[model samples]
Target: MTPETSDNRTLPWFARPAARTWRCPPAPAAVRDFHASLPDYAPTPLIELPVIADELGVGRLFVKDESSRLGLPAFKALGVSWAVHRVLAERPESGDGAAPGPVTLVTATDGNHGRAVARTARRLGLRAHVFVAEGVHPRASAAIAAERAEVTLVAGSYDMAVRRAAEAAAAPGVVLVQDTAWPGYERIPGRIVEGYSTLCAEIDEQLAAADAGPPGLVAVPVGVGSLAQAVVTHCRSRAAGPSASALLSVEPRAASCVLDSLLHGEPVSVTTGETTMAGLNCGTPSSLAWPHLRDGLDAAVAVTDADSDRAAADLTALGLSPGPCGAASLAGVRAALGGEGADGRRATLGLGPDSTVVLLSTEGSEANPVRVTGT
Candidate 1:
């Protein structure tokens, strides 16, 4: 379907085939190797959802449960912690063996990323400055502050806070560890993306141990596309895995920048109005992740706020109480397999009864407290 086919309704949805064949690349050895030394390092669970698979009429369903990652409620800790470590480790003064007094890690976040950054900073004996957009949930802000990070509330959208964070990081003794990248600021964000490869690696290991063949279709939640890109890279790099696994990219209907970027053949910003899936409510795709998404995604779908809520409830009923963004992968799967034009789209991607689907449950329901309904 074309980009013009959106109705923006109670469960507004859209899908289109990828323009190129998706291929994964090798995971970054440096970042993955370093994360192994961190005390909090451990593989999150890859939970089998037999009931959901039965409900969806698929062979099997699996969730990469990231609700408790490195003591944080979200998987953002994986990336943020690694990025902060990389930034500090590379500092010239860091090698001199003197105390790195009062170094500050800075970033803009809707919630989880900032909290993770703050927690990482505090753990590493550094200060943190987190810029959050207006309308960020109180729990998320409080969590960041609890980690001793200074939280600054920007008046406009998340993109605005990103700008402010960039300005602040320009100060001496401050380092930016953002997940999104623009021109001329790619290194740190690049490391952040690489840091996320740990999740995919863990998922692969868990699946192997369970003797579950690689997922035939992997549905990933997309915001700035960093996590999805890392997944694609790791999956592609594996020598013995589902190299043909179809990647289904999901995002909030209100902030479908990756979908829009795919449709437009370039990274185009969208208007990020309020959305229940705050983590997926990014108006712009990361410049560092755009090429990966463009070349490595098999299909794209956008889910409405109601879809997110319902999916969250469904997962909670299955004993996985996920946040809105975390549940979006299931919502996208529902849309792709059961919603409008599902049959044709499924046929196009070769999804069917024998297909195994995997969804990345990227967070728990801790940060977001609001409940939205389908009207």
Candidate 2:
């Protein structure tokens, strides 16, 4: 129950399709208002990555560096803050408003999301009760605690912690603010997904400033499928070339829920396996995110263990120290490009040099290296 010392995570927010923006227009008006009220929050820059471009033979490769976004080193804060904010704004009758006070926001985390929730809750004068599956990364756990959240490690897996969070949220007054959505509990997570559109909006503005347009492709890491859909929807919404943007949802080969879901056109749980990419180890896709992805995403791919580690190392080379799960988008790109035993996966996905690609280094490697080296 100790605090997470540093947690001000990042996110790819405000992605919309050409027709409209707002993933959940029906979402709490206050949530929409909060997004509309960000005067001080500027868009993150889209850094052109020569190294990645040259390797993939792409004309250009861009990175939306979440690590640098708001300096939280991960994209979790966007969802956490938005979700908590919505929950508090909804329960106006409660004393102390959105402040955590006696009631706490609860959720499970394999990595950044818990820390994000904690960070947001603390900032709003609220408390967070974070549940982590057994063996959650020590640094990730430390980060959550650093935010002054109560970190609870359950005996089972991330799913188990999620179950506990749901149960806790069911009680009166306490809120279960989570990123992954389940049945009848779609609004909060959907708001989190909506928050990611801001990332897309920023990328568009940055590209406009450079006198260029949107990228041809955007690779997204799929945790519960929210991020992938969020980014894809935003990038494609704009009027653009023939194939506006192609999304490649990357998952751990072992725990490839979105991949399996895409392949089957229905959600399914893959048995969990050992992988260093804890955040990307989700076994199922969010039903809320499923439809958007099924209709919009171009393809889905699972990355190998070597791909994950090599990507971590490669990101370090990119001057972006990314945690295993965070660097997964770049890792999958490298694999698809045949850079790391992925000669066919790239061609199979129809990727080539002419394409402009964007990757989100979702986290910083303050912990992944130590975990990887230990293994």
Candidate 3:
């Protein structure tokens, strides 16, 4: 199926009067400590883009580059490593100081998350089983396999892959470490979402070191809304200050489940299609993530593949190698800050000339490459 194109005059956007109140616990210090203990672990770069900021009419622009996070090409390692460690740590060890039996980590992914799960399994001497949808790229599947994981290709969408992975995880010694959550399967997914707080924590310190105050606006690309949930949790908390930092979510127009859900006032599944932004091609919002998103998001926007491609090209010209998923944040910012009725939209979003902005560039080109025009 082909992706949908947004109206050049106006992009799809939803806004609320005041963000609903949602109490989210701050990320524990242990999460950061655990991530720091990993091999090659370090905080990713928070690059300041003065040129882009001027173009976007914002005071400052920063992109938290997650391209080379912990030796992975994407930010999934932050969540996967912590969740896997927590799960394993909570397991009952036999008196012999060993697990009772062999354990296998299982999950479904469009790309980066699966590879992350496989890497964790390989590091811990456990097995990994990764299920991918039919549309997943060959390089993604191969990457998972390269990590010594047993890769299964599900003949459907990412949602179907998740179902198949869940079924497989029903067996003994197999744990489903999926990032998305459904009823009766909330615990591990919650842990996965909490694990993402490490990224937010890093962003805080990086921004502080640069002498930048809290961002006035933060854009995050959403896929099943896990990372968005983490962003909302960090940005909306009292400790982050009651600063009016509007959280914006970006999704592929063809797979905008989060936007659809927000419009409907409930979590609703949509029909997803192939897109260059493979990592954000989810058809449903995670059940566990929906509440926080519903309450915490200031706005949601959907961008077409063309929009993301252009944004990617622009970032590349500026010496930033962002994948389609990563560039989606910039696409969303343009949609929100430009176009018809943009003045009113900007006013509502509290965006102004001196507003600080941060775009979460969640992946690098190696995760999902796309040919951008003029690049």
Candidate 4:
């Protein structure tokens, strides 16, 4: 079906045939093992919201609460820690007897990813230089600085900040550890995406423990699509069988790069605007992630900031402290399963009253304060 568009945004929902031909190597078992080796490592909660399931008309709803992974308010630590560890471990040894100077990790962020990179650097006795876009909350930049990393405020959008970070990383002894990937810059981002598999692995075990069968739908919030890439890779792996879970990509309506790209059948850069879901306010899809998302995603939806705010409030009322980005899964799900032609859309995506759903609440309230505008 052709997607209806207005104001350069695709309408609330779009679905396509789930691709079975896209194959990927299983994420290494060592990724989870490495995370388990971390001092703060523990499986985050897989919270069941039966009330929400009843409301949304699904059998069961589980939210993978990544609010406090590794002591960070967001799940980004899983990827950043593993990626930094791999990069440092693979660094070539000094040829001469002289010792090497301290390595400085550099990257761009809207909020959480930069802090994760900075925290990794601090733990390794290295330096970090984080670049952030203009209008980033002072508190977000301050949080990165609290890690002892030097923070630079770029006078442009997140994409511009990414470019600036790349330029700085060109200098000797600096490494760019961005989660988003372009053509020649995919290896590290691939590792970052691999690191995110730890979250999915935990979800599998947790679902078993809860006696919940395989998920029928898995909803993820996309920034540059790294996390969604990881989710698609994990859910579409050979082990998930032919009846793999349907994947949904959610993004801020004003910055719905992945949704726009999926609708356009290509990687399309968007002109993003400010949104309460700041972490997902990305303009471009990661080149490494685009192909996986293109083939593996079963649906894509974009939510307004107001939609996310209400979802956040609802999650809070349900006793979960999800930030706007984290709460966006609910918004997307609501959009897809409610409103006009809901029955047809649900049928297209194979949703039913008995279908189990999993939402990746990728961050906590500490990352971004939720502002519910209604009484």
| lDDT per model vs. reference | 0.82, 0.69, 0.87, 0.88
Please give, for residues 91-127, the per-residue lDDT of candidate 4 as tens digits: 8778884556578999999889999999999998999
Order of candidate numbers by lDDT, starting with the best: 4, 3, 1, 2
Residue 312 accuracy (lDDT) in model 1: 93
Across residues 5-59, which tens digit of lDDT does each residue of candidate 1 receive? 3233333434444423455568667776787888878888889999999988889
User: Least accurate stretch of 10 residues (summed lDDT) in model 4?
Assistant: 366-375
Q: Count clashing residue pairs per candidate.
A: 1, 29, 0, 0
* Model 2 ranges with Cα > 4 A deviation: 1-42, 92-102, 339-352, 367-375
Off by over 4 Å in 4: 4-10, 97-100, 239-242, 370-375
If scored against the real structure, what TM-score would every candidate get?
0.92, 0.83, 0.94, 0.95
Residue runs of model 1 more than 4 Å from their true location after superposition: 1-24, 94-101, 238-243, 371-375
Question: For every candidate structure, what is the RMSD over all alpha carbons to the true structure, in angstroms?
Answer: 3.3, 8.5, 3.8, 3.2
The C-alpha stretches of model 3 lying farther than 4 A from their native spots are: 1-10, 20-22, 94-98, 239-242, 370-375
Write model 2 residue lDDT over 75-160, tens digit each, in one string. Answer: 77766667666666565553745443366788887777887788777777877899986666677788789989998878776677
Q: Compare candidates 1 and 4 on TM-score and give the better one.
A: 4
Model 1, residue 353: displacement in angstroms?
1.2
Best by lDDT: 4
Residue 214 in candidate 3 has what lDDT? 84
**Overall local distance difference test of candidate 4:** 0.88
Output the number of the TM-score-best candidate. Answer: 4
Q: Write the per-residue lDDT of candidate 3 for residues 142-223, one digit (tens) a residue.
A: 8899999999988888899999999999999999999999989988888888889999999889999999988889999999
- Weakest lDDT window of 10 consecutive positions for candidate 1: 4-13
